[model samples]
Target: MGGFRSRSESGRTGSGDKGHDKGQDNRKRQGGNRGGGRGGNKGYERRSESHRREHDNARRRIGSGDRVRDIVFEVLRKVSTDAAFANIALPAALREQKIHGRDAAFATELTYGTLRMQGLLDAVIAEAAGRPVDKIDAVVLDALRLGAYQILRTRVDDHAAVDTTVELVKANGEAKASGFTNGVLRTLTRTPAETWESRVTAKVTDPVARLALQTSHPTWIAEAFNAALGGTPDAPATELADALAADDARPVVHLAARPGQMSGEELALVTGGDEGRWSPYAVYLPEGDPGDLDPVRDGLAGVQDEGSQLIALAMLRAEVADDHGRWLDLCSGPGGKTAFLASWAMGDRATVDAVEPAAHRAKLVRTATSGLPARVHEGDGRRLAEIRGLDMPVSPEGDGFDRVLVDAPCTGLGALRRRPEARWRKTPADVAELVPLQKDLLRSALKATRPGGIVVYSTCSPHPAETRDVVRAVADQTGAVIEDATALFPDLVESGTLDSAPFVQLWPHRHGTDAMFFAMLRVTA
Candidate 1:
């Protein structure tokens, strides 16, 4: 949902050229001897000439002056130096660079692959630099890391990686360090990346820590994932390892066909995507940018995660017999969910009031829900009562909507693959700060819902503190009953039943969607 699909599948799977090892291929080719005859000598000479020509062709393909690497450097600088998000910064750069076909694909691969493996790359860089990576100039380090990424992760010829990287460094006025950069990269490429993985992770005996290095995740996040996946006694080492690998894998783009606008089947046909198996209105994005698609640009459908579409649809599908037909989106920003909910409500002759604190995000919500019966209020959701003033009327039973969605903000660990640099930006302290606010938002959403109404609390995170713990706290304080939400999507659930009581958490490894957590709290009097 609003995710990327790269042309070259480098680093998309955690296996990064592992199955197609160039070294192993060369060994296989050189292992046997040719029969010793003059004719055989001639045959050997012909084969060697052909190999030389092939090598030269590969070198020519890696030639310079493409300007694609420049686009990549600019994005890396914005993300690393300016603390920008890859998802937001990349598109703008691609447009500004005017790169389309194979060049765009190469830029996408280098930028994302380098960022995804930044931690492991840094570890390798530090070992190769003979000092901490921090000791190098920031600009020089970024150039080196980009080079090292191609050498280690991608199938780019090693000579091309080092040569192009040195050229980039020189272009950026780091010519003095070009020799140092070239030496380090050559040393790195001398052995396979898997060998370096073994060397760097050899001393780390803890399963979580070792997995963190192997999977290119922060150690804390690795531990959090392990704990969330039923740690130690219940789940095994392989479970946590698979989850980590999934977090680093590339996520497919998902589109939500807004109700009353377009059908999922029609949208799939127009965009060449397949209809999603989970949500009725969901479509899996085909390759290339969704922005270029007519249906998306026309707002007939918008990019949204299937897991997110499922949760929003679940709130709608909940068995609410009140017939009160009113909806609210508390903390709706960048309004993907609000747009879907509002379109559905429009079909039912209902209305939706979306609350977004930030002005820019509120404007985005307005843009997303344009031409629908949705109102955007720019104010903090914690002040829900004050913000939803007398301008909007409430239900006759009480001062609240019949159905409310609280997509609270929290550590977005569930979407690490989509947001390549987010894993480095988040910390345990961020989770601590967010847990209280998440609970407060849920409480306010519950307070604003009428008795017998349904309030759905959701987050794009699998951390227990931000999900089940928050739901448990609010339910305990308010006496709200948890509905069996997994029943809403029988196809996505494991047992085709709602056995995991109280809340539903979707896993990327198992569900091919962001690890979205959902809880349906019925305001029972």
Candidate 2:
């Protein structure tokens, strides 16, 4: 494992500026006041040691082994053990635990940070424990990750981080591992965050491994990001570190100003956000919960990444020689793009047929597109030929849909920043397993499109196998013409990148959007 050594293995935990003794000296010099950090900040990792100590001391005075950490650990447990999503699980947990204001913000950072840095956390933990992270008990591991995140990346004091984690593990019946947990964290505290970055990556000579260890991403993911940036796994990626770093940072929340209902400017004024760079219907929420906004609650606006809005907007902008009123959103679920599509379709005198195999998500699509000219069909888009209840529109010659969006279910590599725990959960096997399904959906989508109609193939992933390969396979098989999808996007899209590719790929590092890939195909007439 690429991480600093533990006391048990190396007989020393190493040292640096924020090491235990120096950090304690700083806290003492500040007289241990407990007012500087009541809540967390966007830059919690970089806060001064004394400032973090005051934050920890304030928590200690109010509630040690408290609700904030309890909530964070619970969310981590759910994510690691139950595969629950942090974004959804965290809000419910915060509400249930009655953690709000600064504490809620604190919990959010700790939870997302712990999950985001899991790979590095595990490596550090394995070194600190002198064993593979896989050997640690699940509950113990969760507690350790929470504590390690605070110790390595937050303003929480080293002592507070260690003690609270020990208390948490004991409270959760990991008493036997509490000592083990304590020793590991204590060993971790001996080094500062900056030093830890170097120590962990020192042994790894491979550029991908070094970036992976430093940025807390899986090696495969770092390699994928590098490859997407036009680098080979063996070569040093000029932008690989930046690409991976983008996932490590907190994501800016974006909202879609429902087409025909409200404009981006109107939504920005209501929510105190800014208009997005690309999609005219996109608004960027800098801070605060979007659910609290009236527009979001009123269905006038919904949280959607700008990349997603671009997918819908790009599909609408793609040229279809003869206009038709029928459109389809294959695999539409938790329907952000579907709503945007249907809203535009409502005014264009068109109808939309959205297919979702999952029942719960189908309901979400129905809810999202309730007032629009859209119909939600609960079935597999991969079997469009046999589906009996599809309410799709046809042309005068019984032709299929004019526009189709195969926002194909993918490995979700592009949106790792939004979904914190997703990176750790996905494996190469998952990608291999999903590729066939991606091809199936694309093939079915191409087959369902009428001659001269356009089909937009997209994924929230930049993986070659998922993005280019899937589109290439389907187009090659069907003789579908791969149109220059870059032209479909507005000129405001990131410059010096993707302007020449036949498709459009938006990166978070470049475009401040999810790594969404778009390819437009015109069916042979």
Candidate 3:
């Protein structure tokens, strides 16, 4: 019967089956049925779905300039009208807009750059714009600022800059005003404004005023740094200009391994570098996705700066011995240093209590120390001495903590590279305003520490009023002995006069790190 079967029947039973099997094999090769089991099909479907979503997201971001501009405009409007801090509002805007990658980078540059050069851009706009810049509608003013930044500073082509900015105005229901924006930007392109120096020299008579205007810094701040550097004839201009023009680049992300939780070698695998020479627990990484590293993702290590790690290590070394005792971080908020202190105190019988005045900022302290063991208190540091006196269990041996860190809040002059807007916003009055608070905080931190215990006062600023002056006044008022931080970190310290009163001042112009100030004081019996 098989031999007598028709050709169609033979084909269906043999060739037809082979053809069907080949088709299935090809489908499997194309990732259609490679996951053949029930579980495999579900997994394959999920991965394929994720890829399609990612593709769609990329497509959405491609022509997202208008949306980005609108969001940025809203942020700028809020900052101007509501007196919002641009740093705080910009992040929220970016998150709300769901902007990422190149779009995020562009928005960041546009917003920050426009704000940073607002004074100059406004002056130019005032000249080019027919209406007074301030008198123009807020939205229109922002449009002009954005357009001015592109035309004057960025490499964006003149026509695109004008057209995009005009489109932004038109989209906001100012279709009639597009011609106005167009004409102003066209005139601006034809005659770009002179450099900041020319404008400063033309406007200001005093050299300090000229420097401040040119650099976009407050004149008083320029004067303060000048005085702090011993008032050299040219020091004011040099230091002020350097501070303002210093690397506006984003800071490097640093990582430190938690004791027992991770080793420096382990962090090295994450940061792609060996442990820092000055700080064995510190790992330096060039900017990248920190979440990609297993140790970071697992919370075995944290992102911290080498300088901050060094500061914490310096405090640890300042203790007469590595014996376990209570440690306090006064004014610990957005707690980067407090986290390091917790890691350093991990194995020892040492315990750390980080105090932050603001509830929200205190939450940051808790979050930073989440993986580590540390006690976070949300209260005024000024009252901490009394509170701890009541709550802390007194050892039969003596008083409270073995060491204290009063990282006082100040004008963040040293961290301008990290906070680009800060250089322009800070004034000498801001420095003056912080001195009393710093003094109070220092006195409280000193009172909280046991006799013979160390208190390290630190600020991410180079201002004398916030640094040497505060330390000097405190040392004169109390029986605290000044210790030389440079003597402790010889490799990191710059050669300077010890008569400068035994403090460490790291300058960005000199040292590679943020301009940090440190003073180690010890209370004597």
Q: Considering every candidate listed, which one attains the maximal lDDT?
A: 2
- The candidate that achieves the highest TM-score relative to the unseen native structure: 2
For candidate 3, the per-residue lDDT at 96 reads 83
Candidate 3 per-residue C-alpha lDDT over 1-525 given as tens digits, one digit per residue, 9 for 90 to 100: 000011111111111123334555665667755688889988988997787667545543443257777777767767677867777888788888799888888877778777766665666676665446767777778888888888777777778888888877766555445666777777666653344225334766676666655555556766765665555545453555665455345566667887667777778875686566556777767757676888877767877766666678778888554334788898888988888788768777577888987989989999888867689987889887455433452544357577889989998877766654555567668877999999999988777777778899988887888998998898889878888876777666444422244777765555456777888988776
lDDT: worst 10-residue window of model 3: 1-10
Candidates' TM-scores? Answer: 0.84, 0.85, 0.77
lDDT of 1 at 11: 28
Candidate 1 structure quality by residue, lDDT tens digits, 1-525: 101111222321222223224545664566344546668867887897687667545533443344888778878989988999987888788888688888888888899888988888888787766678888889889988899888777778878898888777766755546667777776776666766666677867786787788788898888877777777533444667788888768799999899888999999999999998778888988677799999899999999999999888988988776647778899889999999998998879888889999999999999999998998998888887577551334665666778989999989999999989998899999999999999999988888888788999999998889989999988999898888887776675654423345578888887778988899998875
In model 2, the worst 10-residue window by lDDT is 1-10
Ranking according to TM-score, highest score first: 2, 1, 3
Each model's lDDT: 0.80, 0.82, 0.70
Model 2 global lDDT (CA atoms, 0 to 1): 0.82
Model 2, range 234-273, lDDT digits (tens) per residue?
A: 8956877778888867789899998889999999998889
**Higher-scoring candidate on TM-score, 2 or 3:** 2
